[model samples]
Target chain A: MQSKSNNSLIKVRQLTKRFDKLIAVNDISFEVFKGELFGFLGPNGAGKTTTINMLTGLARPDSGSIEISGLDCSKNPKLAQHLIGIVPDESNLYPELTGYDNLCFCASLYGMRKHEREERARDLLEKFGLSDAANRKFAGYSKGMKRKLTIAAGIIHRPEILFLDEPTTGIDVASARQIRQLIANLHDSGTTIFLTTHYIEEAERLCQRIGFIVQGKIVRIDTVISLLQPIQKKHTMVISVLHPDEGLHHKLISEFPEYSIELVSKGQFRIVSEKVINIGPLVRCIEETGGEVSEARRIRPSLEEVFVNITGIELNAMKKEKQKNGRSS
Target chain B: MKRWIAFWNILLKDMRAYYLKPPNISWGLIFPVAWTGMFFIKSGKGLDSIISLLPGVVAISILFGTTSMLAVTVTFEKKNKSFDRLLLAPIPLRLLMLAKTSGAILFGSINAFIPIIIASFLADISHVNWFALVLAAIMIAIASTFLGLFIAVSVSEVFEAQTFSNFFRFPMIFLCGLFFPITSLPIFLRPLSYVLPLTYGVDILRGAIDKGNIMPLWLDFLIILGFCVLLFAISLKNIHKRWIM
Candidate 1:
C-alpha cells in the first residue's frame, strides 16, 4: 500500500499554539503544494494569523511540526524563513523610514547585498506603482500606499512561499483590484501563495483551494468549486409574465416537477431548482402555461450564501460571537 | 566585520536622531558649564587650584550627562516599543547594547570638552597637564557608557530610570569630589566615596590637572576598568535574557 500524499512544499503536522490558557490553534494539520494559491479562509479569531506567525518563525508553536521546503522549521528557522515571505496582518513597516528604505532594510535582513537590495527595492517599488512615493516616509503614507509598500517589501527577496494576511482589507476598489492582480501574477510566476482574508469574493476569485477555519479548527478544506457545489445545485430563477394567469403557478409546478416555484405577484414567480441545467425546462413550462416567460434566468448562489450555509451565520454575526467570546473569557 | 557594521549603523542612527533635535545637546552641555562657572566665580583664592579642578569637574559632568541621557532614552524607547525592532533584528544583543552605549559615550566625550574650554577662558589652566586630561576623559567615557548600559537594561521605564539616576547622580557629584576635595568629606563618608567608580575617575582627572599624583595611576585605572567590566557583564546578561525574547 502506498501513502496517500503528494510532494508537499509546506507541511504542518499536528500544529498547536496556545496563549497562556487560550488555545489559538488546536493541532491543525495541512499541506501546501508547490506553486499553489491556497486561501486560508475564516472569520476573525480562527487561528489563521497565529498559524502564519508560527510558520514564519515569529512565534513558537506549543507542539507539533512545521516543515517548509522539506526543512524543519524548528531545527533550521533561518533557512525556513529564507524560503518564506510574510506580509503580517498588522503593518510592521518601520514608520521612521521611507518606502524605499523599508524595502532595502528587509532585503538587508535577508542578507542580500547592498547593490542588489537597492536594485530589487527600486524594481519592486515600480512594480507596485509606488515609485512616485518611494522617497516619502512611511509615517506620512496613506493606508493604501502603506499596504502596497508592505506587499512589495515582503516579496523583495522572492521567497518560494508567500504569506499574505488580509492583503486587501480596507482599500478602495481600484487599489484592491491592483493588489489582487499582483497576487495573481505572483501565483502565475510559480510562487506558492497562502493568503488569509475575510473577503469571500477575493477567495472566490483567486484561491485554487481554500480551507475554512472555525474556532481554531479547520472545519473544511477543498477547492472553491467543491465548496460551492451544494449552493450551485440549487439556483433561484425569477420569472416575469405579460398577462395574469391564475393557474400558471400550479401548471408550471406540475409540468416541471423538478423546480420548486413560488408566485410573488400576478405576473411574477420565484423558481428554485436543483440544477442550473433545469432552467431551460422551467422556462418552457412557464410559457406552456399560457404565461409569457420574461426575464427568466438562473441566479447561482454567491460565496456569501455558501459561507452562511457552512458556518450557519453571517459575517457580522460571527464577528459578534468572537467579540463576545473575547469579552467573557 | 558584520558585527562592526551593524554596530556602526546603530551608532550613526542615534547620532543623527540626537542632532536632529539640538535641545538635547544644549541641555547636556548647559548644566556642566553652569556648575563650572559658579565654582570659578566663588573660588577667587587661587587660580592654580581652580585650574587644577577644572578637568575633574568637566569629566564628572560628562559622565553624568552620558549615563543619564542614555538611561532616559533607552527607557523611553523600550516603553514605546520602538526597541522591539532592533531587538528582533539579526544583530547580537551585546552589539546592540555596545552600539547604543558608545553613541552616548561619544556625545559625552564631546560635551565634556565644552566645559574645559569655557573654564580655560575664565581661568588660566594652561599649566594643567592636557595629556592627562585627555586620558581621564577617555576613562570617564568608558566607565559611564557601561554604567548607562547597566541602567538601561535594568530599568523598565523612563521615569523610574530618571528618578534612580538622579538619586545616584547627586551623591556622586558631591562625594566623588567633582566640586570639592574628597578629603573634605567626613572620614566615614570618605571610605564610602572610595568604593564609587566615579571617585577614582575624578582622582585621575584631578591628578592629571594638578600634576600631583596622589593615588597610584595604575591602581586607579585598574579599579575603574574592573567596574566597567562588571557593569558590562551584568548589563549584557540582563539584556540578552530580556530583550532577545
Candidate 2:
C-alpha cells in the first residue's frame, strides 16, 4: 500500500487535546491521503470521536495543527470546513424538517443556489434510496432511515474529505450493508474517507489502511494485511482419521516437528502450524502410518484476534471495564 | 450581498418554523391584546390615556417576548448540539448572529403592532403620530433582540440565561413606565427610568400618540440610537469571541 503522505489530503502534527484536567487525545500525528479509505479503529473512549471533532473544526485542539486539503483548519476554519463533510456519532438531523429539507438546509449553508440545491438534493435522495421518504419529517424516520438521511445531508455539497464516526452503529444488518456499499462506492469515486467503527469485520473489509488507537494514542497504524499478518500466521487445521490411536498422534508430531498435534475423541485430530503450508506432508505421513485422512481444512485467524493481540484486551472486556468505571464514577 | 441573503434566509426559515405556527401566532397576538383590553377596561378614560400607554406596552411586550424567545431558542439549540452544525457552516459568524437577531426583531415588531391595530378601530388613533411611534417601536425591537442574542451567547446554560434576563426584563417593564407613567413614580426612580431603553421607546410612543412633548424629539431619538449601538456592540463582541475561539 502507498503511504498516505504522498497524496496527503489531511495532515496532523503532534496533535493534543485536553478537556480541563483530562487529556482526551494525547500527542498523536497521522496523515490521510486522497482517495484512501482510512479506518480509525478503537474501543469506546479511545479518542476517535475527539480526533474527528478536531479535524472537522467542531472542537479546538489544545495544541498542534491540522490541515485539510492544505488549508490550516485553525487559521482558516471556514475554508477548511468547506472542503470536508462530517457525519457525527449522533444523528444531528433537524427533526422538524423533512429529509429533503434537511439536505436543502445544508446546501443553503454552502451557498448553493436554490435551483442547484434542489437538483442536487433530489439526486442525492434518489442515490441513497430516500426518495420515498424525502417529504416525510425526520422525527418519524426509523433509525436506519435517519442514518441514511444524515449521511446524505453530510455529503450534499460533495466535499473532498469525509469524516464518519460509527456510521453503522445501532442499525440493522441490511442497513449496515447498504451503508458499507455506499462508503465503498464513495471511495471508488476518489473521495477520501476517514471512518471509525467498532465492527472489526467492516474495518477489515472496507479500510485500505487501519490505525489502532488505544488509551487516546495510536498504538499501531498499518495496512489491513500487515496488521493481520502476525495472527494470520497461526493456522489451525482439523483432520478426521480412520484410526483412533495414540500412536498416530505421536507419529504425526514426530513426523512433522513444526506442527502441534492434538488428539480428539474417536477419530479426529487437530494440527496447528505457523502457516497453511505443506499439508501434503501431513497427509503423506498419515498414509505411511497406516491411518486414513478423511478431511483436511485450514482456518486462518480473524481480525478479532489481531485486535486482541495488539491491545492485550478484547473489545468486550474493554467495554465491560468502561461500564464498571461509569458505575463507580 | 451574501450576508444579506444569509440573513434573509435565516429570517424566512425562522418565520416559517415559529411564527406561522398557530400557537406562536396566538401567543404573540393574544397576550398583548389581552393586556391592552384589561388596561382599557380598568382605566376607562377617554381615548387619550389609553393611546398614551399603548407605546409603552408595546415596548414592554417586545422586550419581554423577543428576549425570552431568542434566549430560550438559543439555549435549546445548544443543548441539542444543533448549534455545532451552524458553527461549522461556511457562513460568517456575524452574519448568523445578525440573521437570528433580525428574525427575533421581525417577530417582535409584528407582536407590538397586533394589539395597536385592533385598538385603532375602537379608539381615536387619528391623533397618534403613527410614523414616530412605528419608528420608535422598531428601534426598541432591534435593541431588545440584540441584547437577547448577547445574553444567549454569553451564558453556558439556558436556565442561567433565563435567570440573568429577569434582572433586566422585570425592571425594564415596570420601572421604565410601560404600564403607567414614569411621572407617577417617586422622583428618585424617575431618573433611573430615563436610562432604560424602554423609557425612550415609551417616550416616543406616548409623544406620538398623545401629541405630548415629554422630552425633546432629538433626545429620544439619540437615546434609542445609543441603546442600539451599545447592544449591537456587545452582541458583535460576544459572537466574535465565540467564533474565533
lDDT of 2 by residue, A9-49 (tens): 98888889887777888988998888889999888788999
Checking candidate 2 for backbone clashes, the offending pairs are: none
DockQ value of candidate 1 = 0.15
Q: Which sections of candidate 2 miss by over 4 Å?
A: A1-6, A236-299, A318-329, B1-5, B154-167, B183-195, B211-245
TM-score, candidate number 2: 0.83
Query: TM-scores across all candidates?
Result: 0.72, 0.83
lDDT of 1 by residue, A1-329 (tens): 02325567888898998888888999899888888899998887889888887787656777989898888875345456657788766566767678988787667656676798899999999998999999988889877788788888778888899999988876667777888999999999999999998777789899998888877888778888888888776878777887657888788778877777878667887787666646566666666766676676656576756777777767557556535433221
For every candidate, the chain B TM-score is: 0.91, 0.89
Question: What DockQ does every candidate get?
Answer: 0.15, 0.33
Give candidate 1's TM-score. 0.72
Q: Model 1: iRMSD?
A: 4.1
